[model samples]
Target chain A: MDKFTVLSAVAAPLPEENIDTDKIIPARFLKTTKRTGLGVHAFDSMRYRADGSENPDFVLNQEPYRKAEILITYDNLGCGSSREHAPWALLDFGIRCVIAPSFADIFHNNCFKNGILPIVLPHDVCTQLMEDARMGGNARLTIDLPRQVVVRPDGTEVPFNVDPLRKKLLLEGLDDIGQTLQHEKEITTFEERRAQAQPWIPRIVLD
Target chain B: MAPRTLFDKIWDSHVVETLPDKTAILYIDRHLVHEVTSPQAFEGLRMSGRRLRHPDATIAVVDHNVPTSDRTQPIEEAESRNQIETLERNVKEFGVPYFPLLSARQGIVHVVGPEQGISLPGMTIVCGDSHTSTHGAMGALAFGIGTSEVEHVMATQTILQKPAKNMKVVVEGQVGPGVTAKDIMLAIIGHIGTAGGTGHVIEFAGSAIRELDMAGRMTICNMSIEAGARAGLVAPDETTFEYVRGRPFAPKGEAFDEAVAYWKTLAADEGAHYDRVVELRAEDITPVLTWGTSPETVIPVTGTVPDPASEADPGKRAQMQRMLDYMGLEAGQKIAGTPVDVVFIGSCTNSRIEDLRAAAAIAAGRKVAEGVRAMIVPGSGIVKAQAEEEGLDKVFLEAGFEWREAGCSMCLGMNPDRLTPGQRCASTSNRNFEGRQGPGGRTHLLSPAMAAAAAVTGCLTDVRELI
Candidate 1:
């Protein structure tokens, strides 16, 4: 994972609300163990027609939006499924920041873990961003995590707040597993005490 | 100190270490794994040269990818076969207790966990699948985790979690006959909207919730995720104890009694404070049907589709318009008698034996309407055999319903059983997302009895009418 400090990229506006994980990447595409090829199938049903031709009217299928790296959507984005494939697909599709009014908790957490910045702005601000995103390829939105601001193509900055820990992790490119391992000693002590209290639980050795 | 809610008690007890930022390394007592999410987590562990910290604490099962038809035949979908095969290989290599495809113990991870007694009162349980909240019916503090967090739990039997806010949904009054837990759940979600419980774990309390059987309780908790809640729970009581008494992993005799003594204290204290509270009258609950994409886009079977023109918020009105357009339903149209192309009566939600019996009772002596494709996939191999022992399968098969093997079939359509494009289905599954069953498929989430009623009528029909 690369450290996510700042990046400037074209913004694509998907103005719909409740764009669920199933819509982000349908369940059928989740069959693969590997994560790389999912970007092509990201919105499988909506992006492609029954005959496998691109749905020209869909947002991502349009000319400048095909190269979008920031997605500005509406309320409750990533509202269903715990599949990390949702973010994998978004990252694979070159979407680094997803600005929405709100996000489902699990999907939001998964995004941070996978190096995607899920920005939760106010409804009005999200609307503003969505409108700005409509500028297509010319709108190069810059997301600066360290500065906590999203710079629009016109040079105006919209400030955002992120959990200090999450921002630190994102900037350092650290996943939760790496941070959790730092508490190994405390965890081992807790387990030892727990095993004493609950004798029914079996112990396993790493050989 | 403030009076602690049941959620606070369980969560606080599980905390191994709480960091300055409020993230706690919560010890997981039981970790449930399935085909779709665990493969990559296992791959992560292998790549990092770390072994499972506590293999015994974890249970693996094949459910999501397995075919519900033709058990003996090789899975035709290559990718689906590889997913299941990868799980088998990973579980074998990791030495975790596993329930392979068609094995008696194999089933939906959510169902098998509680049935096998791996889920118990006061335990912290998690799975890579969101519906892990199903185990919370056992009075456990359970929620779903992503693949990366799954690997965290696999390696340490712990995952870092921030505590969730507590919301108490207290239901009073007696539920009417033919109304089940599913109806109550749908009524709740319909009232609260899809994102109502986003940051909270809901405790379903009061006389109405306590009255439901274990299976009914499970059904309610299973869909908590659909309401955007982390989990839902009912306090452990006699019904819970009786259900767990002699299961494969339940404690025996003296141990059981001691466990029961502790479990009694797992309920919320009289003066416990909840961050949020909602009250409902059980008698008000009716057979619910989702007319549109989201679970929150639900209405009573007797009610009409919501008119977007009636919505005050412009954004919400547009959202409603999109939903109505996609569903091919007119505003103000009645939900009942809306034609259904298919009916699916199985999933982690409403796939227990009790759920089957309810649908079977409805299906008995009635034939599915002409042109309606109806299927009943049991939740697990054990459930399938149990349904057959009671001749439930025969009743369904005779009623023109396809009695398939145990798996998540047509619920999100990962398998061969699916609704074609533009087809509409009345399903007993949790989600009603657009294209959830298949590309351009429409789903109406309802109870098992309602689904059975839809099958017989070839439309979304109220179970009360038939009963």
Candidate 2:
């Protein structure tokens, strides 16, 4: 994962609510072992038509929005399923930030783990951002994580808040495994005590 | 000292270490894996040269991608075949116990874990699927995790997690006739918007919840994710112990007694503190039908579509309009008698044998309405076989339903079973998100019995009326 502090990019507008993981990347495209080549499949059903041609009405297929790096969406974005592929596809599609009124918990966490910023703003601000995003390629919004502000394409800015630890981890690009290992000694001691207390509990021994 | 809520009791007991930042390293008692999400996690394990830390504590089941139809034949979809095959290869290589595709033991991961007694009280369970919360019904701290976290648990047998705030939903009074757990769950979600329970683990209690059986509790907990809760739990009691006593993976004899003794102490103390609380009267709950894309956009079966103009919040008003447009429904139109193209009754949420029994009871001596595609999918192969032995399949087939094998059939449309574009269905599944069952498919969440009612009427009809 890459450290995320400040990003400035064109914003695309997807005003639909409850844009679930299955819509972000359908289960049919989830068979790949690697995360590469998933950008084309991001929003697979909506982005492409039954005849395999691009859906002209899809915002991602429209001019200027095709290269959008910031996505502004509605409430309950990424609402269903716990597929990590949702964030993987978004990041692969070059979307660095998602602005919404609210996000499903798992999807929000997955976004941070994959270096994508999911910004939760007030509903009115999200509405304003969606309108700003309709300005096409010229709608460049800048997110400053350290300062907790989203600078709109215009000079106006919207303030936001994030958990301090999450913000630090995002700024430092620290993976959860490495951070968790910092307390390995305590974990090992606890496991030993638990194993002694519950002999019937199962454990696996590595050779 | 405060009397901790049930969620706090289970969560605190599993913590190996806690940091000043409030994150804790919690030991995982069981990790369930499925074909859809485990392939990538297993691949990551291989790439990192790490072996599973606790293979005995992990169980894999191929459910999501398996074809519910013609199990003896090879899976026709190339992607589905590859996903299932990769799981088999990975499970074999890791030396982990797994139920292969079409195996009698293979079922939806959430369904298999509990039915086999692998999910126990006072344990922390996790899977890469959101319905992992279904295990929390057994007095456990269970929630969904991402694939990266799945690998973390596989390699370390622990996950770094922040404890969720505690919430209790108290449903008092007895449920009226024809009301089921599915109806109560929908009512709860509608009461609290989709994001209301965010960052909280909800414990279902009170008289009505206590009256529910294990299967009913599972149905409620399975949809906890829809309410944005980290997990849902009910204190383990005699009903729980009886359900687990004879299952294959459960402890035997003396061990079982000891486990039950421990589980008996898993309930909240008399003055337990909750961060938040919501109360509902069971008599107030009714058969629910979702009129929009989100689970929260629901009303009682006897109600009508909500008019957006009546909404106080501007954003909510806009959302209602969008939902109405997608659903092709007019505000103020009654929900009942609204035409339905299909009736699907199966999912991790409501596909257990009891769920099947409810549907079968309603379908007995009735025929599905002409032009309606009605199907009943059992939760597991065992459930299917048991239903057949009890003639539940006959009841369904006689009613003109397609009696299908187990798996997540027509739930999220990963397989061949799905609705076509613009099709509207009355479903027993949890989600009603846009295109969840298929491209341009509209879903109205309902109970199994209500789905049978819809199948017979060719419209959304109140099961109580039929009864």
Top candidate when judged by TM-score against the true structure: 1
Candidate 1 docking quality: incorrect, acceptable, medium or high: medium
The residue ranges of model 2 lying beyond 4 angstroms of the native Cα positions read: A45-52, A131-139, A154-159, A202-207, B312-314
Which residue pairs in candidate 2 have backbone atoms (N, alpha carbon, C) closer than 3 angstroms, thus clashing? none
Give the C-alpha miss distance for residue A108 in model 1, angstroms: 0.5
**Can you list each candidate's DockQ?**
0.56, 0.48
Estimate, for each residue in B108-176, the C-alpha lDDT of model 2 and write its tens digit.
Answer: 888998898889888899999999999988888889998888988988889978888889999999999
In the range B275-307, model 1's lDDT, one tens digit per residue, is 889999998887788899999987889999999
lDDT of 2 by residue, A40-137 (tens): 99998789987889999999999888888899888888877899999999989999899998898899988988888889998779889888888767
Model 1 / residue B391 / CA error / Å: 1.7
C-alpha lDDT score of every prediction, in listed order: 0.89, 0.87
